[model samples]
Target chain A: AAGVIQSPRHLIKEKRETATLKCYPIPRHDTVYWYQQGPGQDPQFLISFYEKMQSDKGSIPDRFSAQQFSDYHSELNMSSLELGDSALYFCASSRMGPVNSPLHFGNGTRLTVT
Target chain B: SQQGEEDPQALSIQEGENATMNCSYKTSINNLQWYRQNSGRGLVHLILIRSNEREKHSGRLRVTLDTSKKSSSLLITASRAADTASYFCATDAHAGNMLTFGGGTRLMVKP
Candidate 1:
């Protein structure tokens, strides 16, 4: 089975720079969720989209924005990046109807701020 | 806000011993799920128990939910070094599909 795919397994950026992370969800999955996990910390919900429309928002920062494309893939963009933004960015996908369904996760992108 | 809170932030045990972790949440939820992450990798779904269900089992894993107390427990029987990882309990509340995760319990099984 095809799992969620995240690009740029590792990313390095400097302060005040911009970065874009992309996600390709599993086929037929209509919901995409983004999460950020800092070192030695639990994953934090960032934002989510259902069928290309933003459905829920979490602790995502103002400098960060995300959107799901017509093909069900999603992208998270961060600007004016800060050192605190360095973390493992994960993308998960699930079917929209059953909220209890399991979420398929990608390996995630490791963002490092220099 | 984070929902589930797990106990014993870290646990260490010998191989073949059983490992158990507990989780408590604040609000009512539609379901609770257990996930495992090795080091810095992505999370892998272990098992899920619905709100109305009391207990569920998969392979060597057992999950129990007590909606009354808003708590849940996960037990891994006959543990192995391979099971060494961080375990987290996540809850999806009646509010929406977004899952609120716990602080996670780090388990280290010795060989």
Candidate 2:
């Protein structure tokens, strides 16, 4: 099966404009997560979804929101984007098995808020 | 907040040499996992060690976890140029499935 897929591989938007990024996790995977990576930095958690519910929210600003639909697709929305929003957004998925399951990630969407 | 701290922010080694990286974390954890990310790419799972286990091995990778000290170490045996990447350690807290990752250590394997 194809790995996780994210939309708008690269996006350039003017500040204050709204931007939405979409993701489709691997088929049969029940858990999905979103993470942000700044230049020369490690990935930081944004939020997580499991079984179509928001399992956890990370240290993101209120402008960021996410939704899990039917346990397959998840979308991350940013309103009134600021220059700080420029970074790589990654979508990850994993099957609910042993708690030791490792997350499988997509290539990620590069969003640049100019 | 995350519970782990990785040491030696960066390491440079010859392709045939060994590379060892260390991590220390606060609080008890269900498990600790290691990941590798190539430049501008998503992270790839490397190995995992449970709280109850002391050491685990996969192919050429060796991982050791010390619950008493709340520390872990990753050793890459006979590294290759392709092994150059940023390595991170993540902790799965005893109470949840979410993983809290540590600051990564970038490794450069000189060919």
Candidate 3:
């Protein structure tokens, strides 16, 4: 089975720079979710989209924005990046509807802000 | 703030021993899910228990949910060295599909 695919498995950026992370969800999956995991910390929900619409938001920073394209892929754009933003960014996908459907995760993109 | 809190920040056990982890949440949820992550890798979904369900089993894994206490537990039977990883419990609240994760329990299974 094809799993969710994240782009730029590893990214390095400097402070005040801009970066964009992309996620290609599994086929037929209509929901995409973004999460951040800092070293030795739990994963934090950032934002989510359902059927190409923003369905929920969590602790995502104002400098970050995300959108799901018509093809069901999503992109997370971070501007004015800060060193604190360095972490593992994960993308998960699930079919919308069943309450018991589990989220399928991608390998994630490691962002290192220098 | 995360919605769930997992017990035992870390655990070490020998292979063939059963490993168990507990999770407590703050709010009512539609379902609770357990996931495993190997070091520096993506999360792998293990099991999910609906709010109305008391227990569920998959392969060597068993998950129990107690809605009354807003708590859940995951047990891995006959654990192997391959089971060494971080386990996290996530809750899907009535609010939406966003899953709030717990601080994860690190399990090290020795062979």
Candidate 4:
């Protein structure tokens, strides 16, 4: 089975720079979720999209924005990046109809802000 | 904010032993899920127990949920070295599809 795919498995950036991460959800899955995990910390919900629309927001910073395209792929754009932005960014996908469906996650993109 | 917190920050057990991890949450939830993550990797969903269900099982994994106490437990029977990883419990509130994750319990299964 095809799993969720995240682009730029590893990214390095400097302070005040910008970075864009992409996610390709599994086929037929309509919901996309983004999470950030700092070293030795639990994953934190950043944002989510359902059917190409922003559905929910969590602790995402103001400098970060995300959107789901018509094809069901999503992109997370971070601007004016700070060193604290360094973490593993994960993307998960699931079907929107039934509740309790397990989320399928991608390997994630490691962002290192220098 | 995180809604769940796992007890016993870390555990070390030999292979073939049964390992149990406990989680406590703060609010009402429609369902609770368990996930495992190998070092520096993505999370792998293990099992999910709905609010109405008390217990569930999948392969060598068993999950029990007590809605009244706002707590859940995950047990891995006959654990193997491959099971060494961090386990997290996530809660889905009635509000949305978003999940609030717990701090997680690190389990090291020795061969």
RMSD of each: 1.1, 1.4, 1.0, 0.9
Task: Provide TM-scores for the models.
Answer: 0.97, 0.95, 0.98, 0.98
lDDT by residue for model 4 over A1-114, one digit each (tens)?
899999999999999999999999999999999999999999999999999988889999999999999999999999999999999999999997657578899999999999
lDDT tens digits by residue: candidate 2, A7-112: 9899999999999999999999888999998887768888988899888778778988999997579999999999999999999998877565888889899999
Task: Give the alpha carbon lDDT tens digit for every residue of B79-105 in model 1.
Answer: 999999999999987445788889999
Alpha carbon lDDT of each predicted model: 0.93, 0.88, 0.94, 0.94
Descending-DockQ candidate ranking: 3, 1, 4, 2
How are the candidates ranked when ordered by lDDT, highest leading?
4, 3, 1, 2
- Which of candidates 2 and 3 is the stronger one according to TM-score? 3
Runs of candidate 1 exceeding 4 Å displacement? none
- What tens-digit string does per-residue lDDT give for candidate 2 at B1-111? 266678888999999999999999997899999999988888888887889999999999999999999999999999999999999998877343677788889999999
Q: Give per-candidate clash totals.
A: 0, 0, 0, 0
Off by over 4 Å in 2: B94-96
**Candidate 1, DockQ score (0 to 1):** 0.72
Report DockQ per prediction, comma-separated. 0.72, 0.55, 0.76, 0.71
Q: Write the per-residue lDDT of candidate 3 for residues A71-102, one digit (tens) a residue.
A: 99999999999999999999999998745488
Ranking by TM-score: 4, 3, 1, 2
Docking class of 1: medium
RMSD of 2: 1.4
